[model samples]
Target: MKKKLLVFTGSPRRDSNSAILAVEAARAARKAGASVEVINLSRLRVNPCRACDRCRDRGPGQCVQKDDMKKIYPRLQQAEAIILAHPVYWFTINAQTKLFIDRWYAFGADEYRCFKDKKVGLILTYADQDVFSSGGVNALRAYQDIFSYLGAEISGMVYATSAGPGQVKKNKTALKEAYNLGRELVS
Candidate 1:
């Protein structure tokens, strides 16, 4: 079977810098012979996790709140690699991305074994060059912790700095790195 890659964009703005990078990554993944799916969190109706613990009690991949997240669950399960692309808001991932990730608690709580050994990649765009924008290195560290907890292998990451709308396109280095990261995940 062909490897499946799922790319999730957390940018709420259409054509945002993060989204552009994500598209590039997805394109490269496709070229590398992986089936790729790109999902925009902004277009989804995912809600915050209510901490209901129903999924834990019911079983793995089960959540009480029926929303667009239901659609995400199946794709996530089927993916061999997962890519998260987002712009930094106050030195962290945007609110939309956070909310989407938070809902993954259901899978985490249930100890879903599907996530184990799955490849994970991160594409982050930030306006600041400073590492201490929101406490020192918190965003990357937080994502690292989450991926580790899920038992996913960190395939690669790209941190594109000084990225504003249309700015990331000019950063040839970051774009190349993002594309390479995608290719690496499938390889």
Candidate 2:
């Protein structure tokens, strides 16, 4: 059976640099015989987690929020790997991606058992010269910690510096790395 992979684009801007890179990654994954789905978070009406603790009582992947996340919960459970692609905002992950991650608390009932052994990939874009100056390192660290706590296996991470919209398309190396990341995760 083909590996299932989900790519979530978190940029609020359409055709953003990060989204472009994610597209390339998804293409490569599809070529590698993995089934890929790309979801644009900006277009979805995913509400912030209310921390009501209802999901704990309800069970894993069960959130009280009656929004787009309700649909995503099932997809998340089915996917073998997930890639989070986003541009740095305010020295860290943007609000859209952060909100999505926060809602993962519903899986806490099982201590994130579903994430154990699952593959994870990260793609980050920033405007500054490098990761340190752009604070991409902070976002990377956050992902590291988050996935670690969930017992997920981090397949790879691809990041780049793109100052403007769609600038990442010009970054050949990052694009290649993103493609390789996708293939590697499925392998």
Candidate 3:
């Protein structure tokens, strides 16, 4: 069966650097014979987790709050690979990405082991080139930890340094790497 890849972009800005790389990655994944679905969190109505633990009581994949997340749960469960694209803000992922990830707690509560062995990728954009000074390193580590906790393996990652709009377009190396990362997820 062909692999299914889910690409989630957490940038609120249209045509963001991270989104550009994500689009490239998705295209490459499709070329590599994987069915790809791209989800732009900014266009969705996902809400922050309320920490009610209702998913725990209601069984796996259950959440008390009714919102757009209902549409994402099934996709998350069915994906063979997952790619998270976002910008580093204040040494961590942006609010949208963070909220979407927190909602995964619902899956965790149900002991949803379907994600085990699935491949995961990350595309991060930052203005600062220095890892320590920019906090990009911390964001990368956080993504690694989260994927690990979810029982997924890191397929690859691309960190693109871009300060202004469309800056990533000039970064041919980063773009190629992002595309390769997507291809690797399917391999």
Among all windows of 10 consecutive residues in model 3, the one with the lowest summed lDDT is 107-116
Name the best candidate (by lDDT).
2
Query: How well is each residue in 1-187 modelled by candidate 2, as lDDT tens digits?
Result: 9999999999989669999989889999999999999999999988988989999999999998889999999899889999999999999999999999999999999788888889999999999999999999999999989999999988899999998788888889999999999888888
Pairs that collide, model 3:
60-110
lDDT of 1 by residue, 1-187 (tens): 7899999998888568888888899999999899999999989999999998889887767899889998888888889999999888876778899999898888966586878999999988877775566322677899889888888898888877655577888989989999999999999
Q: How many backbone clashes does candidate 1 have?
A: 0
Candidate 3: C-alpha RMSD after superposition: 1.1
Please give each candidate's TM-score: 0.94, 0.98, 0.96
Worst ten in a row by lDDT for model 1: 129-138
- Which lDDT tens digits does candidate 3 get at residues 1-187? 8899999999888679999999899999999999999999988999888998888888777788789899889888999998999988997788889999888889877576867898999998989976567888998888778877877899888997898878999999999999999899987
Return whichever of 1 and 3 wins on TM-score.
3
TM-score, prediction 2: 0.98
> Which residues of candidate 3, in runs, are more than 4 Å off?
none
Candidate 1 regions exceeding 4 Å error are 130-136
